[model samples]
Target: MIYGVVNLRREATLPLVVGNMNKQQQVIDTVIDTGFSGFLSLPSSIISALDLPWSASDIVTLGDGSETLFDLYAANVIWDGQYREIYIAESETEPLLGMALLYGHRLQIDAIEGGSVKIEAL
Candidate 1:
């Protein structure tokens, strides 16, 4: 099981450890974005700091229905006590943890500031 917390903004968030091929890693606070169907999104600064390798670029639709191209990078992430390789999209917004990363897991959120957030494997 993975444990997290709801922030003051009421967003369900999880702290994730993201790494590069060289083993450089950083702890990132990621907001849980159910509307996102991909794996993960991180800011350019973090990506640069980690020196994540570029994979490809793809156009993605935003929440406001606008389309924009995003640069994708290969990253290693520690999720639920396991090391997993996943794609990370470059975004200017706060890091986002999407449904792709949450698939096969049960998510429970209390929906309030300082509330508990939990993810249990199926």
Candidate 2:
């Protein structure tokens, strides 16, 4: 099981421990965005800081219905107590935990800062 807490902005956030090929790691707070279908989205600055290697490119539609190509990177994240490899999309916005990462898991959020949030594999 995984646990988290709602942020001041009322967003459900989780702690994601990301690592680069060199085994360097950093723990980041990521917002859980159900609307995003990708595995994860990290700010370009974070991607650069972590020195994640480019994996591929993908076209994604934005909330405004505009399509844009984004760079994808390969990185490892401590997920559900295990180290797992996941693809991360480069974004200028806050890091997001998308549906792909939430697949096969249950997410519960209280929708208030310091509120209860829980995630667990089914």
TM-score of 2: 0.96
lDDT of 2 by residue, 1-122 (tens): 98989988888989889989889888988999999999999999899999999999999998789999999999999889998999999998899999999999999888777998899999
- lDDT of prediction 1: 0.96
Error of 1 at 47 (Å): 0.2
Give the TM-score of each candidate. 0.97, 0.96
Candidate 2: pairs in clash: none
List, residue by residue over 11-94, the lDDT tens digit for candidate 1. 999999999999999999999999998899999999999999999999999899999999999999998899999999999999
Q: Candidate 2 local accuracy as lDDT?
A: 0.92
Most accurate candidate by lDDT? 1
Which 10 consecutive residues of model 2 have the lowest summed lDDT?
Answer: 108-117
Worst 10-residue lDDT window, candidate 1: 58-67
